[model samples]
Target: MWLTGLLAAAALVLTAPRWLPARVVALRAKVFAKVNGDNAITFPNAQVGPERFQEVYGHPAANGRSRGAALSDLFWYWLSPGAEVHQEHLEAGPRYDDVARTTRALLSGPADELADAAARCAGRVLDELVTGRVTPVRLRDLMVPVWAEYCYELVFGEPCPRAARDLIAGHADDVVTALKCTGLRHPARRERLTRYLARRVAAGDVRRPLPASLSPAERVHYLQGTFFNTAVVQLSEAMAHLLLALAQHPEVADRLRRDPADDRYFAHVLDETLRLYPLFGIAHRITTGEIDLGGGTTFPEGTVLCFSYPDYHAAGHRDPGVFDPDRWARVPARAAHHIPFGVAANRPCPAWRLSPLALRAATAEVLRRFTLHSTVTHTRSLPNRGPCLLVRADGPPPRHLAALGAFLRVRDRWEDVWRSVVQLVLGTVMVLHARRLRLAGRYFETHDTAGCPPGHRPPDHRERAE
Candidate 1:
């Protein structure tokens, strides 16, 4: 009887790789909500489906950023040192406008101009490697230096040295790793970046205007939060997703390579990649005043609204799971449910126009040099950092990538079992720690704060916006 009981326990443990991950994920989300307190409401508010995604997202009353200051704590903790000044977290008003203006100015180049710069920077970053050999590459890792140089030039009109590239890449990687719950926040690594940006800002190395409303310190943090940190992190992540998509779908890659000049095809590919794997996840806002959505539906003041980009993008489409760029031929990108960039009325991505153009250029450069291939299961939350193989484009048909892909797939599944567990532990701890730290709360208390009092919303965190 004892032997049989032990054997059963072992069997359960052995097969955990299959079932444990999903359970752990669901539990983690529950813990996350509990720790954070579910005073907020989620969007695509089931009653409406995807029909009112934009309506709620773009609503003027749903425009408050700092109102839900407790949720901001988790974000600020994860993206610390200068996270308080990250443009996305700032409340709407003159300060946001100034930061937005600076961003627009920096990203103001023509589409062709941005593309050329991106291609030039990308081509420069790709060092010569052994051809005809399968090389495992982390797409985010590869794209970081490319974007580091490109973004560096955007801030300062000179070439980025290898040293600067390393610093920028390290800072960006640390932030992304923490954001993905793969690692803990390392304030020392982030502080080093803060110091560097401080010096640059003091020296007026910032060629563009920062928020004039900020003090000297706030100016430094603004540069780090906006330019060096968020811009580099996002652009690199988007490039990784794009390259991974090309790797998984060789037909699309082959077509792109054959017609390297086809910007339209490239654009479609980018739109689809983002639609499938959006960079931003849930972007939540708190209402400053009551919002009436006609039909007698109203979201009361301080109602926390969560706009989930992944859910919104996945719904109301034909075979939303399938990766089909041809779908774009029938409908313009703007017309689709895709909001890769946020809603224009409520703080859209400042680089909306430039991001697609830069990604297209960087991808074109990559395809010109090498053929990408991957068999790893592509996921929206690519915490695996996009496993892929790079083959020289000019080389003969490469050998079996199946072995590598198979290994990655298995490794990823097991990793998910452990990673999910880690996320639960870390996410809960950080949520609690953030609540204690009250980074955003402190910032708001000192500066001008927004409307919502934490935990004052509906009956439960599970309550929805009707």
Candidate 2:
């Protein structure tokens, strides 16, 4: 009879959500409607374009390169798993140091005993192209002309008397042709590259091919390369989101500017920002096992469902209406539940640690050098969040800038002191909680009682008749 009652109770618990108060459903529907409407208003004609894939130069170039390096480092760390590779090499090194060094000497060096001058020249040309600083006309310019010189240097262990330059002055087209035909597809990407490579290849250019000694498979492997382009794109989107948020909430930017180096504070601001304006508002998963998520929602095997991150964040958070980090500050460590990236059990961003760390580092550095003050007005009368800050980079001292300098410095210092105070307070509370827990454990062990131990009552106990 007891088991029957328990089973019935469980059934009610499962079905309770479907029978939830109408208010809850209406609230969720309203929020979803607003979100969709905002998306349409902001990006009605959103679609990927050809120029999106092409590289940018100058400041954009510098920014992209920085993001690319971070991405490369993160990828290598992910691939190696246990290898404690430094981020710098993961960003720039061709491969593991030993292998990269050997390849450089053979395919990229001036060493007469390595490979040949052509290979070396080709390496230089490709290096420039990959960096997006220069463009080349042909493949031999990179492979034949450069490889021959490198090979001669490797075989004889001495500088070739022949000038490696003229070996392919007019043969640049051949090298470009090989690069275009190599491998990898993305119609837009291919189209842009073909214009550069095909024009030269059509001019009857000739240069050394990757040494006939290399097996076809090996040659293909040599051509297959890794790039940080994906990382660059992701980082750019993240930056755009962050900038937009900051523009909307100038006060948060001001707070962060006060103590830019405090990783904890920076993290809190980012968390709140993400909660309010998540980059990925939803994530989906195919269930593999039976699990009960309270209210009649028993997810069975192979069931596909999408988890609304923004909605979950709103529901689990203390005060969903406000963009306040103080709410996060108040959540008990064990009960904390904000999933800007995704849920803790299954994060959408597998590279969470690295990506956030890179972002924090870059933001901290930028804040250190400049005080970003903006006067840009946000788009009002819409649910969409965006920032329009007129950014001004200010620093150091001048006679007229004295007052502004003092204000900025004071603002930064106050944030530092405030964070230290909060940490001290939290530390005290944690120590008190630990002491209480230990004492309670000892009392229970001695008294041999289960549940709430007899008469050393819980705090806020009610008086009873004697």
lDDT (10s digit) by residue, model 2, range 67-141: 211122222222121112212122122223322332333333323312223334334533433332111121112
Residue pairs with clashing backbones, model 1:
38-461
Q: Report lDDT (Cα) of residue 351, candidate 1.
A: 86
Candidate 1 lDDT tens digits, 233-275: 8999999988898898999999998998888888888888889
Error of 2 at 407 (Å): 28
- In model 1, the runs with Cα more than 4 Å from the true position are 128-132, 450-466
TM-score of model 1 relative to the true fold? 0.92
| Range of the 10 consecutive residues with the lowest summed lDDT in candidate 1 | 456-465
lDDT of 1 at 145: 84
TM-score of each: 0.92, 0.36
Worst 10 residues of 2 by lDDT: 52-61
